[model samples]
Each structure stands twice: as structure tokens, then as C-alpha cells.
Target: MKTDSLSAKAKTRIKRPPSEVFAAFADADLMSKFWFTRRDKGLKEGETVKWYVGSDDGAFAFDVLVKELRKPERIVIEWMGQDGNPARVVWTFEESEQGDTILTVEESGYAGSNDAIVERALDSTGGFNQVVVAAKALVEHGVEVNVVADHVP
Candidate 1:
């Protein structure tokens, strides 16, 4: 069998500590405020979480398998992409000397036609970028930018 894959990466520096930034992703409630519309539970290693977007009629849902979780540092998860390909997403949090956290998101394992792989990778990059930006706004200024929701509708 032939194997083809693509990956996307995005990074952002938030004016907050690593712990705070990490919590923004680990906790379901906090994440809902910035990213996903709703998450069934907090992220934990070896656990599965359901995330939903939009209302009941038009809602899109997906299951994320938490592959790894390191508090204030890193997290890895696997989920099915829009194209039905298994994708792995990694989040890394690094604390800088200026008392800020640099968060990086990498997603890989898009397998399909060249065009489909490229499209998925590009979309993942933009989505992750919006996630981090929304997280920064929520964490630093206590404001929800609603970037995730904005992208949906």
C-alpha cells in the first residue's frame, strides 16, 4: 500500500504562564470558552472526549482520543479528520523568560490524494491558529474573541 501524509503547524505566544496556558486546553470549561463549543470532559491521557460545534440540528461532533498528557508542558491526541483520515495533533507549551508561554500546535497523518491532504493540512493550520489566538484573548484579557464560532457561521 502507498502511504501519503501531510502535516500543519502553528504557534503563538500568550502573555501568561505555561500552567495557565496549558489549563486553557486541558479543562473543558475553559476550552469551551475559547475553542470548542462543548467538550464532554476534561482531557486526560488514555481517555476519550467528545466535542461538538453548532446547535443540535447542524451540530458536528468528533471523538478525540487523548494519547498523552503532560501538565503545563504537552498534550497529544488522535482524532478523525473531516476526510475520515486519522490525524494526530500535538500541543507543546514552553515558558519564556518574559513570563509568557509559547504554545505550538502540530498536526499530522493526513492520508489521501495530494489535493485532499494539502487542503486538510491548510485548514488545520488555520484552525489551530485561531484556537491559540482565542486562547490568548481569553487568558490574557478575560475576553472571548469567539473565533471558533465565527469560523463556523
Candidate 2:
């Protein structure tokens, strides 16, 4: 059966430099503070990383293969979706005129039924929004708001 693919994109402006905002996602230590509960290590091209969320009891664990990594600019990774199909996630970081960073997240290659693809895309949009907001709070204000975790359970 031929399956349809879907994609989602989200953008946010953070009150920090592009390097700082990029570090928030590239560095496992900083990412764990706001997004995932734990990550094996920092993102590197041609490497795979495991990220755990929620309780970290192995219930919500996923593996991400880093396809490309450009410091303070862009990162691309492939991960499996709920349907067990691999999907690509790309993150772009651009420095704004006001010294802030404009972060854009795009996920594509979702293969499934129409309803499933739409649902997954919507969920990704909301999830990425929460993640960027949380990262903003943590990086700009030094506060761990836990917005992403709050939506989990």
C-alpha cells in the first residue's frame, strides 16, 4: 500500500544569540533541562543519540540519527514515528536584527494514513512550540518552566 507523507513546521523568536539558542538544542545537558528528560550525549553528525522523556523508565525512549549538523545554524536528524516509519527533522537557527534568534523546526516524511498523518503533524507542531518556548525561558531567563513535560502526563 502506498502511504502518504506529511510535514510540520514551527518557528519562534528567542531573546538570545543564535549560538546560545543552538546550544540549547545541540547540548544534551541543556536540552535535558527543558525538553527531554535525558539524552545520551550532544548531537553529532553521523551519530545516533537516545532521548528519554517523562519518567525516564524506558517507556518514552526514542533514537535519533544525526544526519547533518552545522553549528549555530542548522541540524538534521532522522527518527521513527509512532507508526515506526523514519522521519526527518530539521532545525534552522538565524540571528535576528535585534540580536535574538529566530528558530525554525521542520519535520517531514511521516508515512501513514491520512488521519494518522494529520494527527501526527499537528502533535509535532504543538510539541515543537512547547519545546521552543521552554528553551526560550531557560536560555533567556535561566528558568526551567517544564512546559513540555507538563503536557506529557
Candidate 3:
């Protein structure tokens, strides 16, 4: 697989409407069901929200800056990357042929040495891959995959 890159994208078809899928992301409580364990607040334009994640080791938190928000359509946010660099994540919601939501997530701004950048990019790509799949299970089947938490072990 191609590794060395500054950005990565993951797309998935969710058997739900755009609004429902969007709520899975925009609403902090719903997001905890699939991705981060919890957050300080829901997403809002011009605001930075703290997202806490759980793992076998313990829990850690990160800040996600909501750069843009467009209801059941799109959202853009910037999260901290290497040494204060900001990595941008853009999530888009599209209506599919069956009236379901086509969710797309793209993250960029991987920075550092050649190997460092590639490693970070690969992790981000893989992480997002797991996230969307977990989200699909929760939103479509109401199953908590515990994906991110189980990533290490």
C-alpha cells in the first residue's frame, strides 16, 4: 500500500440518512458511541472541543478545532499533529442512491521527517478506517464495535 503521503481519505456507505450520520459526528454523545470515548461539548463552528479517548492503557484527550460546520452536509476541523502542527480533518455527508448517507473523511497536514510523516499518515489512515467501520455498526445495527479501544490489544 502507498504510505508516504501528507493526507489520507476514507469513505463508507452508511445505511442511514445524512442527518443521522451527521449527528453521529456533530453530537458529542453520539460520537462517543463509535469514535472518541467522550468530549467536552458538541461540535460548533469557531470552537475547539476536547475529545477524550479510552484504551487499555488509560484515557487521553485531544482538542479538535471546528473550522467549519454545515449541518447534514460537511464539517472541517483541525487537530494537533507533530509538535504543534495542525492536522485538518474534513468530513462530508452525501446522499446515496438508496437514500443512505455516503460518509467521507479526509485528514491532512502530516508533518515531520520522511519516516515520521509516513508513519503518522499511515496511523491516521488506519485509525479512520476503523472509526468509520465502527460507526457503521453503531448507526446501522446499534452495535458497539469497541474498535478504537481495541486497536492496540
Candidate 4:
């Protein structure tokens, strides 16, 4: 029940190999199926990709900077608004004890005081929770999850 004033982490269990799940993220086409629909340049070290999400009515613009990229294991990216501030999402992929893959999405670096950061953290938590779930569905069951459902603003 924590809010956005502080950072938060979301986790999901996906019944897929780490490499496969990782592919769903590294590949732009694969990523579009579960996450943002729009396709842009793929992520690479020292590369920043811009995505034009959804229609003009609900379009959101953001930049993703690939900080660390390791195939089928981990990906660390910094996401931010046009002003280059707001949130940073770090996605970690690991194999679980049951052989399933676990994806952990952590967001930190919010602009504001401790109270304000924790309050706004809710917004980030909700987005990443949905994203991780969507990743699980798309990779494991071939189902697509709509993150915009009941989305406020």
C-alpha cells in the first residue's frame, strides 16, 4: 500500500526460460506484443530508444537508456520523462527454484521529498506491476495484458 514518494519493486512469476523471457524484452517486436505496442530502435549499450505509444489520444513519450544488457539474464534501463526526471525502471530476470523465470522490476529515483516520493511511488508501482504481469502472460501463455485498464490519467 505504499505510495510514490519512495521507490518500489514489483515481481512476477513467469513460466518460461530466462532466455525466452529476456528475448521478449530485448527484441522490439516481441516487446510490443506485451508492453508498449509501438516499435522503435532496439536497445543497446549507450543507446537511447524513444517509443511512441498508443494512439495520439493516449500517447506518451519517454526515453529508455540501456545501462546494462546481458542476454537472457538481466537488463537495466533508465526511463524518464521528457524533462529527464520522474522514474527509473530496472528489470532483472532470474530462474526460480521450480525452473520458472522470475522477473523483478524496480523503480527508483523520484524527484521530491521522502513523503512526495512515497506518494508518487504508487503510480510507478502500479505501472510496473502491470508490466511484469503482462510479461508473464505474453511469454508464458501467449496472452497479452492491457496495462491501461483502469489506468488513471
Per-model TM values vs. the true structure: 0.91, 0.90, 0.88, 0.83
Model 2 / residue 22 / CA error / Å = 0.4
lDDT of 3 by residue, 84-132 (tens): 7678899999999899999999998776677777777778889899989
Q: Which candidate comes out best when scored by TM-score?
A: 1
- Report lDDT (Cα) of residue 5, candidate 2: 51
**In model 1, which regions exceed 4 Å deviation?**
1-5, 55-58
Q: In terms of TM-score, how similar is model 2 to the real structure?
A: 0.90
Question: What is candidate 1's lDDT per residue for 22-126, written digit by digit as tens?
Answer: 998899888888887664668879988888775365678889999999998999999998788899999999999998999999999888888888888888888
Better model by lDDT: candidate 1 vs candidate 4: 1
Q: Which candidate is the best by lDDT?
A: 1
lDDT comparing candidate 4 with the true structure: 0.75
Candidate 2 stretches greater than 4 Å from native: 1-5, 55-59
Over 4 Å off, model 3: 1-5, 55-58
Question: How high a TM-score does candidate 1 get?
Answer: 0.91
Clashes of each: 0, 0, 0, 16
Please list the C-alpha lDDT of all candidates, in the order they appear.
0.86, 0.85, 0.84, 0.75
Q: Write the per-residue lDDT of candidate 2 for residues 3-97, one digit (tens) a residue.
A: 36557888999989999999988998888888876556688899998887664575578888999999999999999987887889999999999
Weakest ten-residue segment in model 4 by summed lDDT: 80-89
- How many residue pairs in model 3 have overlapping backbones? 0
| Deviation (Å) of 68 in candidate 2 | 0.7
- Residue 152 shift from truth in candidate 1, angstroms: 5.0
